[model samples]
Target: MPKSKNKFGKYLLIFWGLFITPFLLLIIIMFMASKGWIGEQLPSFEELENPKSNLASEVISSDQNVLGKYYVENRTNIHYYDLSQNVVNALKATEDIRFEDHSGIDPKGLLRAVFRAGKAGGGSTITQQLAKNLFHEKPDTKTERVIQKLQEWIIAIQLERRYTKEEIIAMYLNTVEFSSNAYGIKSASRTYFNQTPDSLSVQEAAVLIGMLQAPTRFNPARNPDRALARRNIVLSQMNKYDFISDEHIDSIIALPIELNFQVEDHNFGLATYFRESLRNDLLKWCKEHINNATGKPYNLYTDGLKIYTTIDSRMQRYAEEAMREHMTEIQKKFTEHWKNKEPWEDHREILEEGKKRSDRYIRMKAAGASTKQIDSAFAAKTKMQLFSWKGDIDTIISPMDSIKYFKKMLQLGFMSMEPQSGYIRAWVGGNDYRYFQYDHVKEGKRQVGSTFKPFLYTLAMQEGYSPCYKIPNIRVTFDLPTGDQWSPVNADGKYGGMLTLKEGLAESVNAISAYLMKQFGPQAMIEIARKMGITSPIDPVPAICLGTPDVSVFEMVGAYSTFANKGVWTQPIYLTRIEDKNGNILQEFVPRKVEAISEETAYLMLSLMQGVVQFGTGGRLRGQYKLGMPIAGKTGTTQNQSDGWFMGITPELVSGCWVGCEDRLVHFRTLELGQGARTAMPIWALYMQKLYADKSLNLYKGDFEAPKDPLNVILDCDKYVQPGDNKTSFDRDF
Candidate 1:
């Protein structure tokens, strides 16, 4: 053999041993790992097709306003097209400029990273990062990490083959975390800048992209200086990539990171109480309902449902505003009324009950703490925030004292609905949902007081009683089943001559209501009330005439809407429909309507109740506020001024309000300041004024509709109050 041939053959053998053998071995190992022949298992075809991620469910208003969300990860998915051009450009430039050009892994970038010791850039593509995000778990050892890295590479390759470039980008944006518990670009945009993904500006998009490197370190809200530096780096990359202009880069880089940072919370936003109240039904729905494609029940916190409600955002705003305006005044008045005295002084049992329900007490009790130890813990002064009319008051207080303080805090419930359709427009359940988790509009049951009278009067009207039917305004006594004498008193203790049913209903005369209650009995009243949508338990007692039953604002509003809907009782409905994240309709809802009385009876009731706003207790709505919109309303104050209430009905709407301290004994001592006119009417009045002012709502500006076929009952009491056939047909038991 020749000497030159020998030398070439030796060199080729060395090259083959050093490079080709190891490369082939590596290729074999990677293939085995991809097939799960090694330590870790790769995702199967089914998992690759539909990766699992927690997507938040949204509550949407009738106006399409997002009220709030329910979530496990606070993640929401948006279409790839929903992304702003600036966001995509900034992300690609900063994270992986060769993103679109590469398949799954960047070979050139890997070579550069290896040769340069990773000083220049990372070798991982956006698809690889997305792969890591999907299946990432903390590996204890370095060997496991190596296996995981290989698994990620294989998954990234699979992903690239499955999804388009735009889809991969969208998936990455939707899967990654942007800190503050916000996962996905949609939530990140809102959390950082209060903007949607499509509305994000170049500066905002850069700030969000910058957070991906070190979510907490570069968070614009937490670390503004680091965020600013990181944001400018993204802008520079955009400039280098020619994605943004020189002029645009200069202006954007000069601007500081401006953030409208608000962390997603259940307690923050409009209709917080309503959102919380609706959560129960939603959870039940998620458990009961099935998604046909998945063959499993929907997860309310993860299924990404869109709940469409009938709530008008403008009307809800007005209702909240009115409560804030009037409730503030009443809170001050309540404080003055109980000056130099504690509202809970006579009701110490309430304090003990509250103490038992407290977190500290419950925790200590669970840990086998003695009563003395629990008491000592409660007496210890601690820093906490207390809810007040002004704002959350930060104070150093003992738990015992804080309980007492909260006991004095008066609460409120208010609601409004369309009478004919029973669509609940506005709902305010409590003073503040964060501090008081109880929902007074739906969950709470308090003495409805004289708001209960309408059911009796409606029943009487259904039983062929005239608006001009005369009844003696004398004390009517009842013999109870317990052999006790029960006689209810009026707010004003004056009972004299005969008063027509219209006059009695207008003035809310208890005597006339009692006379009618004695005729029909409480069970008959309850039957009518049930048909009208009152679901609370009522005692079968004649004393119920004086409004003795405990009921919710929700029940009262639904029941009263029966009259305004022309005797067609329409049950209140809030949810209109539910849809999936993909905009597929899942479920639809409709309100229940039933004919409770004749149209003539409804019109007559409307005419009788109108006299209340014209001259009686609720007259302040017209006389003081000068609403003058042909409103029919009733004011109610329970015994000892424990609960104050107002129910207002117009042609279009039926709304009710109730105000009281949490405990029945925690109330105004005198009836003057605690009457519903002073406590609850102003809220309704202010709310209606705002609604009327909007001109968009077009509410409460019309009169109640009369009967289609007129004159089964006489509403013109001035001409019909003669002493003829309309005189007392039934003898009183007095």
Candidate 2:
């Protein structure tokens, strides 16, 4: 009996040992998993900060004063909202109805997913999708996929512990890629339909949610049929789960998956030209700053930055409309002319063919066509077949087509700024931004023509030349340093022998400007121009007075802005401030000012410029457009009419307009068949008319004071004395 009892005890002990051994092994496995020795571990917050991690802080618009995007009104991103109840409900019903109730793994969903993968191939859960987007490296394999699943499970549990179910859903919506270049629901909505996420209809929301399965395959923009099919599946799922009423699900499914299909206006209010100019300027400034620091090229586009710009949306639209209307009129006229002659095909087609022929001829010349050969070619029968037969033969010889072509060429850009505050108010960079990206307003460097005369006048004034002092506008040739005798002529080609300093400037007399340069000495004029914000190097030559220097519209605009701002010059600035995601200011732009001219001198100069608008070449603008304030401006035409320019100012705004080809070739038509005032000025005037429609905004004018220096007064008189005038008041001193 004792032996039988001992046998029973041994059997009992062995069975107990078997049960306890399995529990011990299970504990060891769980500990190993927790320690990440046997499987992938969950990512901690510190792991997210690892240098090798692909994740980076998201960039947001730095504009604080404006809500949402600075330009777009009433548009808000998903990031701005803190997990709205509707959003959470929508996502839960659409993505995973059992998400909150399940552990890291959903058993029924997993089993179903495995069966679907075996049949229709790949399937992923929300955790798996998040792992793919946030953590998994590419070039995927079975091993990598397995590891990813393990990591996802671990991370999903960690996420569940750290964040509420609503927060996880919010982050998922924000991070998921819905379509090409559309990383979040907000961007996806904007890119596909030009609507905000919150504004999305039930149908639209379902379509976006449907994209979760296969974004590219179900992209409504690309595959409408597939998108609709996927959307119906989501609607059915919502109905099956009782998340939405059966009637509502049926109604949603029956509704057409009609997309608004409104594209985002990347141009931003017809200011594409201005945007391009601003972009180029910003790029250049960024590059220069980077080069100075690191001696290497830096691409501003890739750098995460907030670039504030100087464009006024209202002014920009007005400028674009004016330019388009005027140019379209010209284009219509040309088209009509071509149609009247051809009568068989589209006039634009004929014009295009003619352009090609002209281009070939130019190429031939560049490739080495001798003068005699070119003349012979022009006289040949083959030339008629190739060039003259194409379109209006007169277009080659007359400036009409050239003018129309340059206007159509749309190379000109105009920019205006408030010199005192460096506030850029108006900009017209190109006729169309789609065709031409080079912004003449900021990047183009063309000869200033006679518009630069003011600098010479300013120098003469600083040296004691008064506006009332008379000077000779007679035909005179000067022996240049290069031994070439340079003879300057007036706009009308007739010398007005003796004229007051005011008349000389008002008339834009080239001879008078040249004479002033010689009298004041080129070095002094250079100094004055430099001081007034003309950064382009000026040649110390007599022709410099006649505006021989090549200056950018930006430089000229800034210089004129000084004259507008009571002689205080401020650097043109675009950005106001930059801030990080936490609202910490990274950079702030402060307006920098320098005294370019005395307030008295600036007022006097402005008075003379007003005469230019009232009586000179720019006077035509007054007749065409009613400017409600005291206006000062200058009109400039280069030699051979290659460049046409107008720089004008009111007390409130300073603007510069330039019209010319990229090449220095003469190509434009004028009212007098001679100047830019007739062609470019009309464009400028049209833009300004729309700009100043608000009567509340008027020019700021104040009292002017004369200089106190006796020597300055004497010098002003001496420098401005007209030729043949024997009023030698200072002769005794000499």
Candidate 3:
């Protein structure tokens, strides 16, 4: 009996040894790997000292609001102190209940998890999860995942030794990814609620913390119901852990999850077009000005640069709102006009243009796809989200059809600048940037229409043509310098026998403009335009006086700004300064100024333009909008009503607007509906109204400055003629 007992005990001991040996071996191997004794290398000292994470660069408005960011990761680090206690408490309650007591790992929780088969929750400490987040790479197979888990455990212990409890929480919060391009607590708070981390309420904090488990599955904007349920669960956890009272939990659970969902995409912001235009300048700047710390060119994507821009946030918002308001109404009228007609004159050409720009075409071409395959792809009807002023709408439309739809839509570009400082106050490149990216401000050039008359008038004034200089308004035939006889007629086709330069300009008389161009010579006019900062190429031909030359809104606004600034042409400046992540100044930008024309000449031109707004084509400024301030402006309508433009000037600001269809063939048939005053001037009036309503803006009021020295030009028309008198060639005022 004794011999049998001994044998049984020996067999039992052998069985226990077999069961425990593999587990013991795994522990030894993991410990060796953690200490660099095994084949796998642990995180080095330098890696522990400095973590490699992508940080975002911010674009700050002049009013000091974060407009948006340029980033690879969209991560903005915030200190623990900046985080609300509610957020911290929520994270602790939901993620790691024993976060405070645990060093790096909780042995008791691990035992409990093992016994309950992880039904209660994970035993991984916050530090462990952060270790996995920061250092552990995703594994493809189960064996690799086990190896990655071992690496996480080793790094977790290292993190515990290196950082404090508070630091671990902050780092964890900063490293995690929230939904919708929001990478950290600060960014997530801003993206989800349009607020900062420090201002997050208890419920808001819970909603953000609840996203940690699965960002897409519990996105507040995309999956509100699931996100709400997850938020309730987090609040319940807070109650169970005594982080919050039962009354607080009950109150929060009943409260709905309110979200201010602002998408952090490149195309969804107040200054999308401006930012896109600025990107090229920034890239060049980054190359020219290398970073002192990194010994490499600064990356706009990851260097965390604070690009301080000249854009005023309030004015920008107002400009965008005004554009949308007017464009929406205009679009309705346009739809009515085209109800019975096809919007596009050439559908095949439009489709070809679309095919060239389609991302799918580009991708397939890069992958060596055949042209037939590409064509088939474009011809097939596919699901797409089309942009509308109301919102993005999902529908089924072929790529070819989408282009035709976009062509039917009218487009607008607007820019406003301070004449004295040349600071671009507001810029709206298009009605909707997502649909139309062609920037009429700088990249696009359309016939200047009557907008070019100001440049011609500026030259005539410089050549000693007074505002009251009389010119015959009858039809005049020009024996062309190009050996081509050209006769231009006014839009109304009625000839005023004789008219002052101011009156002729006010009426946009084509005959008088041609005569002046023939007198001044197109070469001289072109030189004056160059002096006034018109960068676009201008043909030295007599027809240019009628604004046949194509020019961009940027050039027109800048040229107009010269007249407003009393002939001092300051090149428009978009960026004011740039700073490093630590707020150290990297570069400062100042407007480049040059004298375009004499102060007297500019003032004379300004007075002539004022006559147009007061009594002629732009009379609606007072009759319709009731803007009684001293405003000098010009209205432009291109041939066949293809483009409408308005250049408005005050003592302080100079703004230019262009409204047209993508194709010149698609336009209103009549001048009454498509003229600059009707199509574009109202937008300027509405925008200025909003500007004046904002008392905080303090846009200057009153009149433009008369020439400081004695004027060599006649300004007031009443001096030359009596009121209520109409005599041909008699210089009558009324």
Question: Over 4 Å off in model 3, which ranges?
Answer: 1-46, 97-121, 139-165, 221-226, 292-294, 343-401, 720-734
Model 1 TM-score on a 0 to 1 scale: 0.93
lDDT of 2 at 347: 35
lDDT for each residue of candidate 2 in 1-734, tens digit (9 for 90 to 100): 99999999999986676556446644765686778764654455754332121111222222222211322111222443543343455566765667777754555565555546645423344544554555656636886555556566566655566665555565567667776556567667766766666677666777888898788999887898999998887777666777668768777788878776633343434455555555555556555554222356433443334445455556655666666666555445435434434331233454434443465457767889886665455444332211111223332333224323433342576777766678776677765554355678777788888889998887766655667666667876788877889887776778755776777888888777777766777788888888888888777877888888989888888888877777788887655665432345546787778998887577668877877887887887778676656778888888766677889887667888887654453244333633667646767788778777744445355333334543333324345444345854542112
Give lDDT tens digits, candidate 1, residues 1-734.
68999999999886565556436646966687667676257787888988878899999988888889999999999879999999999989988889888888876776666556668786789999999998778789988776776777778989999999999999999998999989999999989888999999988999899899999999887888999999999999999999888878788789977789999889988999999989999999889989875899998998889999999889999999999999888888887877778776766799999999988888999999999999998999999999888888999999999998888888999999999999999999998888899999999999988888888988888777787777888988888888898887766899989898878988888888989888989999888888888888888888787788999999899988988887899989999999997899989999877898778778877887898888788888877787978788888989888999999998889999999988888888888888888888899999988888887766656677777675655556655634455555332111
Q: What is the model-wide C-alpha lDDT for candidate 2?
A: 0.63
Report residue 203 deviation for candidate 2 (angstroms): 3.3
TM-scores for every predicted model: 0.93, 0.72, 0.86
TM-score-based ranking: 1, 3, 2
lDDT of each: 0.86, 0.63, 0.85
Local accuracy of candidate 3 as per-residue lDDT tens digits, 3-29: 999999999986676566447756876
Candidate achieving the largest TM-score: 1
Quote the positional error of residue 532 for candidate 3 in Å.
1.7
